[model samples]
Target: MKNSKVFLSLCAVLFILPSLDAQTKRIKRPKSRVGVGSVDRFVQESFDLYDKVYKYDGYAAAGTPLDDDDIDVLEEALEEMTVLSESAPDIIDDLDGVGVLKQGKATLQMNKAKKALKYSIKTAKELLLGQREREAQENEDDTAETESGDSPDISGTSGNQKDGADVEAEEEPSNISDKLEVYSKFDFVPGDKLLYFDDFSQDFIGDFPSKWNTNGTGEVVTVGSVEGKWFELKGGYGIQFLPLLSEALPEEYTIEFDLLAVVDTKTSSTARLNLTLADNNEFRDGPNKSSVELPLGQFGAFSIRVFNRINGGTVINSSLNANLRQAVLNKPHISVAVNKRRFRLWVNQKKYVDIPQFIAPDKALSHIKFNLLGMRDGVDRLFITNLKVAEGGVDLRRKLMAEGRISTNGILFDSGSANIQPRSLGIVRQISQVLMQDQSIKLNIIGHTDSDGPDEANLALSKARANAVKEALVTIYKISEERLTTEGKGESEPVGDNTTADGKAQNRRVEFVKI
Candidate 1:
């Protein structure tokens, strides 16, 4: 009796401890030192279980009962997912460490784990109860001396069908079109000229990028699991980052970059991304604080602060709270258009701030610097990628005569085919408008390709692409085909190196020269 009681006590402890721990235990996430590897590992492990175990066939032949191993794996996956779900919210604050993309992915995976666990638990319980009920019914039928019927019992099957029907009845089709229609409000478009672009592909992983300079430490790391390469800012102590260039920034240029913020832990302290324009061609060190008066002859600045939690903080200065929310919650795509002294900033397709009087008297911005505000050590990281600085509001006449040709990346074609994407319509329309306004002008539409495949294939593709553009101009934009001629360069003249993606993007272009 004593031994049996002891065994029972042991079983109770084994069962109760897990539940207790789960209810009370808090995850100890690294404060200033979480790597992409940690996040990737957790996410990959969670997805592996989701794909291999949760998606695996757990049902038997008749009763559709799950084995002990299947139940255990499902339960394990759910438990692991629960930990991930709890921890993700904490780490997601640092845009560079764990951006909107990974956080969104974690949320989805957690939901899957929940659904799979619920189904498994419910199925197991039902199977056990069903077996007992069948046994009782069979005994009653035997006692009554009933003969076996030609047909099997349909009541059990009908009950399952009814349950399924109830579930189906509860669910409604998603209004996907309605959701998509909401995006009709999005009107953000890229600038016309591509002056300078960097995707961080030219930089080797784990090294500081060659094109950028910073006061504090940072490294170029690839989040290979999620598909991006970024320059991750090391937490603690504010840093100023400047992209190195020989030519001064254009007065009416646009700047764009992708940002991911990661919060080391939940904190009232906000994360800040400050972009300051400097008149001098020299590098300045330390925090790029806009509130503080700069040294003599320096340009102005714009700062954006993203709060950790919703309603956690207020927007200071001219920064938009909506943009702050976007920066904190999603991998924000930042767009800045500087039309001389006037400036406009858009975060994740929404216009955030527009300053008509951005530049001060007697000071024009020659360069720009990125500054990250410091939080707790090991708690915050800011990541930046796809930095593009382009001249906005094109001068068509200047581009044609001064440059001897009008080149554009605006005209695009479908992948692996000569078909045009709908988004290319805007550029095509602009070109058509230019042509229509100047009836005396004739154009030789030439196509160019990156050095990727065979020369012959590239030549064919480029020629086909050029022809397709001409056809689009004639059919859609109603341009005269007789006014246009076509040719292909086939990577013979590349503006950029073929080794990198950014370089390849530059190499693949379409030009219309005076005929």
Candidate 2:
């Protein structure tokens, strides 16, 4: 009788399995590739228009948008990006090739679609996990509830339960929820993208990641050749992970690279990797501070410092393993990760550091505090052959950094300073990059001077400096000065101090105050 009962249950499950399988056929999966004769033609036409739109050198073409139907023509083209952003990643390893700047609206639309896809994937994952947990709990509760009742003998009640076996079997597969999850197999946004950061590149973000600003303006970052590095110096951003990070990110993530310094410098003008997580605008409020320094080589080191509004400051209380202690000062394969709040640093694939947990940085859900920024100087060049950002890796600092949003403040030079050095020019271009990310922004350019510089001289100088930068924007950049303004604040306001040379330098600055 026992054997017969077992056989019946097995047969019941087998009979019901096929029906369960059919329910999962809800939405058709995206084809690995989508193309046809007419579809192919449409794609090509859209791409062709894309090329034309991106070439907008700060001005429109003669009688453009067909002289009348700007909205219709552009809207049609923008829609194509929905298909393109999804498929482009498959064809090209680097999403950068999509060239979102091909058109303003199109770029915004593409980002929206991609971001939506990511959220869907996340949701689906959560749903799927919740279902599994529910199923497990149901089973546990059923057993417990059953055990609590009077013990059933091998009699009529047990036979009744067996008769309804098929009903119970039917509920098993409903647990495979149709909802997408965070780790969606098809849609999770690839965290890595190789993007250009030089002045020549176009701004692509429609709704930029938070903490990304070009304010505190000094020099516009642009593409320039560096001796050691292959293509250029400050030419491209190594990895722009997020606009901001609000909390301790994934338990594991890493930013690893094999870099070679172009030249050596003693004044600690070393290339840096910034990990910032804060929303207070004040650097100290968050855990990721510039003060937390990571060392690299003796010639130079890969240092971890608290990086935010105030910039890099050595962490005094850090108890990082001495090996992973210093920043990659000169050049080496360095990896940074944050796991369980503890930061781990690695050099050349070797364990370098294990430091204390940092303060959680997310004050708001939408705001981001995590960031990873690389530094390069004109005097000394650094070649980064492979700079990869992998979320959830052995390196704790790198992990948190992947989610961290980068700030544009450090790109420029000291406050009250207006030299626009070659190094910081890339920064200026970077800021322009942030502005260009959202075309709707109107900017006011204000230049300040140290108190000692003679107010009149400083004011005149400030005005000239603003105009000089304006020329770069109007002429070199071709951005419409329609929304741009230049003002001079000649030492009337001091951000820092003017008594010391450093303070004086800090006081003289040109700002891109948001309008």
Candidate 3:
């Protein structure tokens, strides 16, 4: 009976294989753009293989025993995926050399496919091993029962043990400290003095933020699994969202924010979120402005545009094709640094745009304006939080060496938590560099917080945050733990008023003091 069931399953697989092959053949290849078409087809086929392997892994993990036939099919799929992943780099190189596709476009997809293949292979192997072990044990039990002329015990002790092991593995939490090594090359240093900071914690849910102005509708809302409140801006052609600033922006400053987009890629292909630095903080676009327009959801190929208009005339109109589709859908940190005519931008840890003469040095870029274009009214959504602006050009190393103490609000953390924000690593990196250069420097790290929560809880959070910073230095930067000590003053040490947003931003700072 088992043999007949296996034969039927194999026959069913054989019938489905032809249909899959036919579907692959139906994909039309562009004759005029052979290289581009080949890449697109390759990516599609790789994803299809990945989906199959993922499903097979799920079946195996759900305690469903994969028979020999099923194992054979999974092995074949894994081999094909492995070949595709191994050939990706060479394929990307050839296409890039031919100028058939934009640089990094194919490479991005290749990297993603390779990563997926790696995890899928690992999962499939573990599941297959478990299945084989169970099969071997069952055979042994059958042999014993036949030899002793007794019925075998079928209480499923082995199966329960396997399920319990899987449960334990699933319950293990991932360590963020282990992931910080990837940011060793990250060099985005935030400005020294924070001019403005807002995580939308001060605003009520479903209400417009008091410190912001917008022509279109927007509300502060909390997103699932994301920390703090976010301002969700409605989509339209001429809609504009502006933060109310007391004074015009300086020539040198940095801006950082967290962005999340939830939209159907097919429908939101043409949607764009524009970050504009203009002369005024109003709903209307200023005459002189420099804008960074990012596409919301184009999965295949997309471009980031930087447009500059000075003296009522457009000067800089540049675009670079980048693979930011996945990053946009996931929560991505956006960082921008402006120094005179030079402008630079980073999405997460990767720097996407850097122009030497992008901004107009003559005009005062006072306001940061946000505008959404080409999105559906109710279907698409965009949210942004932790919007921070700070003055640039402070040399942290020099300041620390000369003054013996340096205070900075740039080392940010999660709301009411000790988890350090990844972007805040830039500031910590600089401090690490200073320590590396001078091993004799023993310093004390102090954490402070705004008076929003209870004193006892705030104090504990502050101490935990200070300890987190110390751990990052020791673990990630390999700094000596003996050279560092941590303390938290909490709301006891107040550098700014607790009533105002800017004041709260100032008060919540980390200070490195030489001891």
* CA error at residue 89 for candidate 2, angstroms: 23
Ranking, TM-score, top scorer first? 3, 1, 2
Q: What is the TM-score of each candidate against the true structure?
A: 0.50, 0.25, 0.67
Query: What is the RMSD, in Å, between candidate 3 and the native fold over all Cα?
Result: 12.1
Q: Give candidate 1 regions above 4 Å deviation.
A: 1-195, 263-269, 281-317, 321-330, 361-363, 374-376, 395-405, 409-429, 432-445, 460-488, 496-505, 513-515
Worst 10 residues of 2 by lDDT: 174-183
Q: Tens-digit lDDT track for model 2 on 27-138?
A: 1112212222333333344435443332221113111222224323433333343344346344322221111112222222233234333322322222222321223333
C-alpha lDDT of all candidate models, in order: 0.53, 0.36, 0.71
Per-residue C-alpha lDDT of model 1 across residues 64-136, encoded as one tens digit per residue: 4556675455444545544554554443333231333343343333333333333333322333233212233
Q: lDDT score of model 3?
A: 0.71
User: Top model by TM-score, which number?
Assistant: 3
User: How many residue pairs of model 3 clash at the backbone?
Assistant: 0
